[model samples]
Target: MTDHAGTAATTLGISTAGLDLEASVALAAEADAAGVHAIWTSELYSMSATVSLAAMATGTRRCRLGSSILYGVGRTPLVLAAEARSLDKLSGGRLVLGLGNGTVRMLRDWHGTDPSAPAARMEELVTVVRKLWRIHEGRVHHDGHFYHVDITPTGDVRPPLRECIPVYLAGVNPRMIEVAGRVADGLVGHPLFTLRYLDEVVRPAITKGAGRMGRRAENIRITTMVIAAVDEDEEQARRDAASQIAFYASVKTYDRALAVAGFAAEARAIREAFARGDLEAMTAAVPDRMIDAIAVAGTPRQVRDALRRYEGTVDHVILYAPTLGLAAPRADRNVRRLVAIATAPRDGAR
Candidate 1:
């Protein structure tokens, strides 16, 4: 049961989740200068992940560029294909295309996509995108319940920078985790997940799915997004992390994580506070134990020690700036601290 994840070198990255395009681009540049492994953006009703990544690709020179996730059904396969190809070309093939199935409300109400059998829709999205990417030779064809496509390359179109851009699917549900292991290049663990959840449930499910396909689970990268609210003021840092955790906990879709981390009561408290629209009560519901189990929030030294635990759980760890009840400037400051934390030297040179 020991993942021994720390035995291998774990890459560190940063997420631009709450920042605007200008701030994100600037942070990406800074992270690149510090030699962080990758920089990721999120598309959460504020900005297009692809659009933000395009700017980041042009701004940075070394680090890999990615989306924490674009929703699975938000865009047509053709649109996604075009955007992914464009971003990859712009980044010189340094794109990791992350996708996910949004909550049922997001799918049914926001995007008008049917929410029934979401895993199947996500699988079809992945398949169709890859098919669209491989339009160099013969006609590409796909007929699925969620998507339909038949196309041929024309006008001597230039091939995409890479035949297969690494596709990372984000999810915590067992079915989605298994499907991600079967079809995608990586699994993006949500910020709410703990190391216990990753080892106890996520990894085993991925292994089972990969085995069914005769594929090696080791090849599928296990990446996690962590809520990191770094500050010299430890209390302020913890508050930021708690606020973000409360927000994620309020979403019923992620309630399973609370049970896995042994904090279901606290989660229920947070959800109740959320339903009452009391942000402070929601944040108050996040006990220190939950914060310690799921996030890094404190001085730089404390955060460095906390991150070592995750070194054992994933191939990559993305430090996300918390946004719930946090101001833009404060969130931006958190990102700067995360960059400093990520770029700090190890205790001893190997």
Candidate 2:
């Protein structure tokens, strides 16, 4: 676990959307043995991120457990703070809470909350959570824009088990990216990020925001989620990755990111196909150019080279398995290979 260039050691992580608890823990254990640095789970309507991470934490010895994203809306700051404290203690301070202001559709439909002033709300959310964790002697009091916490327990209020848990913001757009840099302990790059977008857009926004706070950009750990599909059949790997990218592109929340990457027309077409319930058309709309730009696909060596493009720019590269099309064992096999390449010694390293 050596630091590189004043940054924490570049580590490999895996993202699992699978809901099966037993199998996910098994995968985490296997990844821990394989020298993977982190295990992240998503909160995409199927499973609870906290529950999933806690399960994986108990199962693995070293790999840090994370919620690739738990919607910041629909929960109070104190509740979120308590959840973070519990998870951090459960994992012995190896918990990283990746948060996001969820999509407008999901926020309204699932959580019954209007998605207005989301950026403002998210800013307060991060602030309040941090304040709650830092309460050492007195009852925490917050009269913020989104939440008010004035808890005065009668007898005893248990202080936070830990001082703080790292909060990583998940975003791709300029405003959200800037918020991440200004407030978050880290930033989780959206899966749709291309090398060009990271350099030209994401990094610049984060750096600018950090500058406002008189903070060094290096202080924020930048972890990117790279869509991956690796197989001996190189073409098949690309196909699987394309299908996954298409699914993400079809969502309206991600349209701005695609447009920023010069894929406005393609994203429009994919969304139209999606509206008409034509998944095959959506898949076809995802061009090879876009896939190569956004994902690390193809054979093992190809994936390795693709990841190297992010070497200096990112602190961690998380393998996002958009493998709804691949079997579990096959996806695991590919990720294990990718992790091996990521953790292997670079030139002149002992």
Candidate 3:
């Protein structure tokens, strides 16, 4: 499908998947030069995605930057707003802020932060951040269920920001989706999904949420993160996808996605295998059917065809190279190939 401007209707984006900081920054520069629509980074106990993006901002001339998602708990709302404002100014107003509730395991175990009523906290965070951006006089103060702050007029407080940064909420469940619809500019879809689950489960949930607020669902942008591997060696592509899916299944936070795809029992088995330190079993247990439903793999044409399933539903495709536990060179090649395939035009589209 072509837009009125004669370009592809849905733009292409790339996710820098927890690569080393140097490699990630280099990829951001390359993706920007190659005319990719956006670049997103994940923040899961690795190099901070925000810091990586800060480095990318200096090297790249175009290509909007985003956090595939940054967790909402660790930083105060004021700190988030300040960083976003600085980054937006540095990037010349090309930043999309994607926020999420970190997994319970990470929030509780690693950060020792409370992991209760996450959806409410996210709502409050969004509210506070926007309020900070809009403030003109006096201090920004919020008396919310999760937070309270009264920043008096100090010499350190910066002037009110002019850019209106877009906020996209990362959600997998119903209540989170409703919270996203009620407050966010967009919703971010996870990689562990089938077109069936997206069309049936995810879309309806967002629609219902939007309907409650008397908002049209179509107005809410949906940016989908999809696992992709394009290679002449079809077996290698599938193998990479299987390993990645198994890893995702091991995370209890993603069980809802598996359940939506009719693989709840398989997910439990994968988790059990993961707990027993049997990663091979986890990969093997990922049925080919599950892989076919979730990942876009194989040859370039094949991958493009698979991605068309998301054409009307997703406003942007955040292509992710999921070659977990693979050798570095091999994984890098997979990412390069997927980028080429994802940015290419549809066959015979002139």
Sort by TM-score, best first: what order?
Answer: 1, 3, 2
Give the best candidate by TM-score.
1
Q: Rate the local accuracy (lDDT) of all candidates.
A: 0.87, 0.80, 0.80
Task: List model 2 lDDT by residue over 166-237, tens digit each.
Answer: 899988778888888789878888888887777788888889888988877777788889898888899988
- Worst 10-residue lDDT window, candidate 3: 1-10
Residue pairs in clash, model 2: none
Please count the clashing residue pairs in each candidate, in the order shown.
Answer: 2, 0, 0
For residue 227, what is the lDDT in candidate 2? 91
TM-score of 3: 0.92
Model 3 stretches with alpha carbons more than 4 Å out = 1-8, 154-162, 347-350
| CA displacement after TM-score superposition, residue 229 of candidate 2 (Å) | 0.3
RMSD, candidate 3, Å: 2.8
Over 123-222, each residue of candidate 1 has an lDDT whose tens digit, in order, gives 8888898888877766888888878888876778778888788999988889999988788989999999898899888999889888988988888889
Candidate 1 displacement at residue 152 in angstroms: 2.0
What's the TM-score of each model vs. the native? 0.96, 0.92, 0.92
| CA RMSD of each candidate after superposition | 2.3, 2.4, 2.8
